[model samples]
Target: MRKLLLLILLAAGFLSVRAQDVSLTKGWKLAIGDSAQWASPTYNDQHWQAVNVAQSWEQEGHPGYDGFGWYRIHVVIPSSLKQNAFLKDSLRINLGSVDDNDEVYLNGKLIGRFGGKTGDIKTGSFYGPRTYTIAANNPAILWDKENVLAVRIFDTGGDGGIYGTNFSIGMADVMDHVTVNTEADFNYGERNSLSKSIKLITTNHYDYKGKLAFKVTDPETKAVLYEKTNDAAFSVGRPFTYSFEIARLEKKSYTIVYTFTDEKSGKEITHTETTPYLLTPYPSAKPKINGADVFGARPDHPFLYLIPATGQKPLTYKAQGLPDGLKLDAATGIITGAVAQKGSYPVTLTVSNRLGSKTKSFTIIIGDKIGLTPALGWNSWNAWGLSVDDKKVRISAKAMVDRLSAHGWAYINIDDGWEAEQRQADGKIIANSKFPDMKALTDYVHGLGLRMGIYSSPGPRTCGGFLGSWQHEDQDAQTYGDWGIDYLKYDWCSYSEVTPANPDLPALKKPYQVMRSSLDKINRDIMYSLCQYGWGKVWEWGAEVGGNSWRTTGDIQDTWRSLSSIGFNQDKAAPFSQPGHFNDPDMLVVGKVGWGPSLHNTRLTYDEQYTHISLWSLLSSPLLIGCDMGHLDRFTLNLLTNDEVLAIDQDALGKGASQYLKKEDYQIWVKELKDGGKAIGLFNLSDKYQTISLDKNDPALKGYTKFRDVWQQKYVITTGKDFSAKVAPHGVMLIRVEK
Candidate 1:
C-alpha cells in the first residue's frame, strides 16, 4: 500500500510539471525572403534557415533586411494530457513581440493577426505583446497531436521576431493572472518620477472584480508612510497604475505590499516590493560623469579628467582597465596622471553608495586628432530656416571671405532645406528647387577662399522634412567629397523616429560610426559634427566617432531664456573639451535673424548680446554665426569683430571655461589662456544693475594680477587682491588677467 501511494504521488507531480507554461523557443524554421506559399502548412521547410524565436531576424542571417518573412514551428501536445484539468478548461497562447507586425496561423488556419495589412496594427504596434485565447471547444486547435504553428512577420527595420521575456503557451487561469511591474528597482531624490503598475489579464474576456490594498512602510520601523485601497475590475488585458506621490522620506528602504481579494471566489493574492528614495531637491549631489563617451589625451600631456558624479556623501568609486601612470580616486572619481601611451583603453567606472551602485563604460584615446580650436563659422539656419538658396549661400561665402575670414572665420555652412523631396534613381541626394546645383554651388564657395559645409541626417529626412542621407551614407559622402564639401552637420532629426525603443549607447553610436566609415573612404577631409542634441553625452565619445564638435544642448532660440539655459549649462562639460572635440552649444543667435524672407534684429538686449558672446567665447563653443551678413549693423559687426574676445575662444590651450564662483545672480566664469593667462567674465544674470566683485586672490586670478579689459581695450591697475565693478543688468565684464 505504501509503494502504490508513492507511485501515485510521483505521477501527480509529473502531471503538474507538464501543466506549466511552455515557451516556443526552439524548432523555428525561417524563410529569408517573403512568399505567400511559405505560409502554407504543407510547404516543405526542411531546407529553410533555422532561426531562434526570441531574436531579431537582423541578427539571424538577415543583416539589413526590412521586409516580410515567415517562421514555422511544430509544437506537440502529449496525448496523456488530453484529460488534464488545465487543458480541459482552456489554453492561451502568447506570441510575445514582433518588430512591426505579424499574422499567426494554426495548421494553415488563420487564428489572429496584428500590426500589419489587417489594419489593426499602428505604426509601432509590433512592439506590443500579443495574447490570444484558444477555447476548450475550439476546433482549430489540435489537442493530443502535433500542431503546426506558422507566423508571418513584417519587419520595418532592426530586430523582428517573437522576442522578449514572455512567449509561451499556458493554461488560462484568470484567478491568478495578475503581474506587477515598477519603473525601477530603486528610487532616489524627490524630483525623480516613479511609476508602479499591476497588469490584470484574463482569458475568454472573463470579467474579474477584486479589492486592491496598497501599503508602503519602513521595513525596520514598521511605520506606514503611504496607504490606499481601491476596487479593481478587468474586462480585458489592461494595466492599472497606482498613484504614488512619493514623499520626502528618509534615506532608507521602504517596503510596498499589495493585497488583492477576488470578489467572487474570495481567493486572496499578495505581492511585496521594496524601493529606497532620497528626498534631495533638484540638482542632486549623486555621482554622475558628464560629457561624451570617449575622452582624448595627448601622449605626454598631464591628463586630468574628473568624472562629474554627485550624490549626498560617502560615495566611493572604482575604475577598471586604467593605463599605467593613471590613477583614480576611490572617493572623488578624479583621474589624474600623465598618459604616455598612444592606444585606446576601455575603462569601466563604478560608483557605489549605501543604497546601491551604478556602472558605465568609457574610452580614453591617448592620441586622436581633429578639433584644434573652437570652430568659427556661419550657418544659414537662423537667418533663413528652410528658404536657403544657392544665390544667398554664394553671397554669404563672399561675405565670410571679404569680412569674416580675416578674423579667424571659415566654414560657410548651408543648413537644412537643401535636399530634394526624394533621392535620385541611383540613391544619391540632389539639391532641391531652392538650390539648383549643389556641386557647382560648393565649388563656388570653395573658389571664394572659404570652405563649404553641408547638412544631412542619419535618417530619411532632415528637420525641414526634406530627403536626407539615411541608407545612402557612403554615396552621399562621396558626392560631398567630389563637390569639395569641407564639413558635414549630421543632425538626428528623423533618426529618432526609426531608433529602437530604449536604444543603448552602442545602438545610438552605430549610425555615427557608419557615417564616419563613409567619410574615411573619401579623399576629401570632411569635418564631422554630430547634432544629436547632446543625447548620450556626445562630448565623452564624440572624438571616437570622428566628431570634431558635438551639440551639447538642444536647438538655441534667439531668446535670453534659451541662450542662458544652453550657455550656463556648459560648466559640467568643461573637462571633456579638448583639441579634437569641443562641446557645441548650438548656433549663435546674434545680429539680425530673418529665419528666411523676414528679417528682424535679435531679441536680446545689448547687454544680453555681450553676455552671449562672452559666455560662448569663454566656454570654447563653436561660434557659428546664425544671421545674415548682408544686414550687419555697426554694433553687430563690432560684437563679432572683437579679436581680443575671440582670442580667448581660439586659445590653443583648449580649456573650456567654468563658473568658479557664483554670488547671487552674479557669476564669475574663468577660462585658462594658452599664454599662462586667464580670461574672466563677471556676468550679471538678473534684472537691474548690480555691483559684482571678485577676490583678486581667487585661484582663477593669481595674486598680484594685472587685468586688461578686452571689450573696452583698456588696462586696470590692481592693488592688493580685490576688484569690484557695477555690471549692467544681463551684461558681462570680460577681462584678461596676467599673473
Candidate 2:
C-alpha cells in the first residue's frame, strides 16, 4: 500500500508541472499620451480606449500617430493559483512583441525593459521574443488580490504598440514541458528524382524512446507511396537528421507523416508535414503545334516568334530553319535572338513531351527596331472608357501635341469601344457611330506629328462587347494598316470561352501569332501591345510574339491598394524588360479620370499620384496617360511636365527599378541609368510620415556621388556619407544620383 501511494503521488506531481499560460489579448486599456501617473496601480483608466493586445494601436483609429503611449490591464490572481507553492515563488511573463521599444511595470514597480533609452534612443529588435522573469524576491507583486499590469511603448514610425499573435502572461513551468517541431530541406520542386533532408526536434530534453515510423501518402488518394520504421530514441542536444529519397512523383501535393510510439507505455504520437512536386505542362492530351502554315522573320534586330504547341510539358523542341544566330528554347518553344540573314527561311518546328510529338511549318521576317525605349504614350481607356469618339480622340491628340509632345509623349492610343457591335459581311470590323471615319481620324491625328493607335481583341467580342478580330486577323491587320494605325492594343476578353478546357502553350500563342503574321505582311511598322492581363507570364514570351509592350496586371484603380498591388508586383517582371520590349502595369491613373457623361478628378490623393508616376517610371512600364487631356489642372500639368522625371522612364538602358531596401512600409527603388548613374525613389506607403535615410556606407551605393531631385527639378542638398528626407504618406522622393 505504501509503494502504490508513492507511485500515485509521483504521477500527480509530474502532471502538476505542466505550463499554465494566461492570454493577455483582452482587457487592455490604451491611452495616447505618456504619463508617469498612468503607471500607478490606483490610477483610473476608465476613460481610456479598449484595445486588443494582439494588434497595433495605429490600426485602432490612431492613423499617422507616433510617439509614446501607455497600456494598462487588470489581472486577477486566482485563489487556487496563488496558493500553488511553485508559482508562488517564481512567475514568468510573456509579452509577445512590442514595436520599436517598450517598458513593463507590475503593480507600479518597473519590471522589464526590452528596447530604447540608455541615454540616447537605441534601436530595438521588433521581432525579438519578449520573455522576462519576475524574480521571486520582488515584494511589490500582489499574490492574494488583483494585480495591475502596465506597459509604456514608444514607436519611432509606422505601426506603434504591442502587436502580433504570440502574446501571453503566465507562471514559470506553465507551458508544455515537451514540444516537437520538424524541418525539411526541399519543399517544392519539379525534379523527377530527388533526395530530402529532414530534422526533428523536441524541447525540454525529454528522451523519446520509441518505435519511429515514416510514411509518404498521396493527398488525393491517401495511398501510401513510401513507408519505413526504426527503433530510435531522440533526446535534446543530439543530432536528429533523417534522409528520404524518392524516385519520381506525379505533379501534386503530398503528405509526409512521422510517428513515434513509446515501447513501454504503448503511447503513440505523430507529426505531419506537406510538400509538393511540380511537373511541367502536367499530363494532358497528345502534343500538337498550332500556328500559321508559313511565318516571317527579320534581320539585324531582335525577333521573337513562339512556336505555339499544345499538349504535355517536358516538351522537346527542334527547328529546321537555317536562320543564323537565332535559336528556339526547347522548354518554352520561344525562338529568339537577332536574325543574321534577311532572306526567306522556311522552317519546320517540332514539339514533343512524354505524351506525343507534332510539327508545323512557318517563316521568319526580321525587320527594323520595334520598341527602342519603353513607349511614351497616352491611352484613352482610363479617361473615357467606352464613351470615346472621333472628336474626343482628335482633342486628345491636339492636347498631347500642345501640352506634352515636346516632353516626348508621342503615341495617342484609342482603346476599346471604337469598334461596331458586329462585323461586315466580308468579316471586316467597322468603327462605331461615335467614330465616323477611322481612316480620316488617323490621318488627322498623324498630321499633328502624333502616332495614332487602335484597340482590338482576339475573341469575337471585346470587354464592352464590341467587334473583335477573332477569325479575321489577316483582314483586320490589312484594314488597320490601310487606315494608317501605328499601334494596336490586343486585349483578351471572350477568348477563354471558346478555347480548350486547359490552355497550353499553343492555345495562348496561336491568336497572337496570327496577328503578328498579319502585321508582318503589311507595309507599315505597327507597334504591338499585348493586353492579356499578364496571364501565363506573358513577359517571358511576349517579345517572342512581336510585342513591344505587354500588360503585367489587370487594371489600375485610383486607390492606394490598386497602386501598391500593381506597382509591387512588377518586381519579378524586371528581368524580362529590355530596350524594345517592356512590362506594362496597365495605364497611369493620374489626373482626371472617370467614365464618360460623369467625368471627375481622379480619386487618388496628390501624394498617391506622385507615387503612381514614380513607381511606373521606375518599373520601366509604358507611361500612357489615363486621364482627360481636355481638362488639365495646373497640378496635373505639373505632374506630367517634369521632363527630368520622365527622363528616368525613357532611360536608354531599359533597366527596370529593383527594390534594394525594404523595411516595413518604406521601400527604396533603384534603377541603373544609361550614363552610369542611378535613379532612386524613396517611397513611404504607410499612413504615418517617415524619415528615410541612406548613406554612402550602404552596400547598394558605391563611391562618391552627386544627387539631383527629379521632381523638385533642383539639387537641394549634398552629403558625402548620408542623406535623409521626411516623406509624407504615400509620397515619393525621386532622385538621380551620378558618380
After superposition, the stretches of candidate 1 with alpha carbons farther than 4 Å from their true spots are 1-368
| 1-739: candidate 2 lDDT, tens digit per residue | 0000011111111222223456666788999878899889999999999987666676687753556788898986554544553435566666655655677889999887765436322232222235566765577667657888998887644356776555555455422232234423353334555466755454544566767789987644668999999776666776456777775776334667877676754545666655433211222357766433333334554444445455645668889864888877776556666666656667877778777787766555454555656777788877787778888898899887666664567788998878887778988878879998999998787666667899988877665556778888999999998998878988866565466634677787778888989988887768899887676788899988889899877556566876887797687788888877899988888777764534545657667788888888887788888888887655577677666677788776788998888888989999988778888999997876677889877765666367777876667566556777777677778888877
Give the distance in Å from residue 81's predicted Cα in candidate 2 to where it truly belongs. Answer: 44
Q: Give residue 559's lDDT in candidate 1 (0 to 100).
A: 69
Output the lDDT of residue 194, model 2: 45
Task: Give all candidates' CA lDDT scores.
Answer: 0.69, 0.69
Query: What TM-score would each prediction reach against the true structure?
Result: 0.52, 0.52
Across 1-739, the per-residue lDDT of candidate 1 in tens digits comes to 0000011111111111123566676788888666768767688889988887656676587654555688898887553333544325666666655555777888787777766333643233233356665665667677777788888876544345555445666555544344443422232334543344544443335566788788987544568988888988665556555555566655334567877676875655566655433211232345443333455665655454555444455778888998888998786556777677798889998877776676777778876454467777899888887777888888888887665554557678988878887778988778889888888888676555566899988877665557768889999998998887878999866575677854678877888999999988876557789887666777888888888888887556566776887798888788888776788888888877746655556767667788899999998888999898776654566677666787788776778998788777878898987778899999988866677778766666655367898886678775655787777667788899886
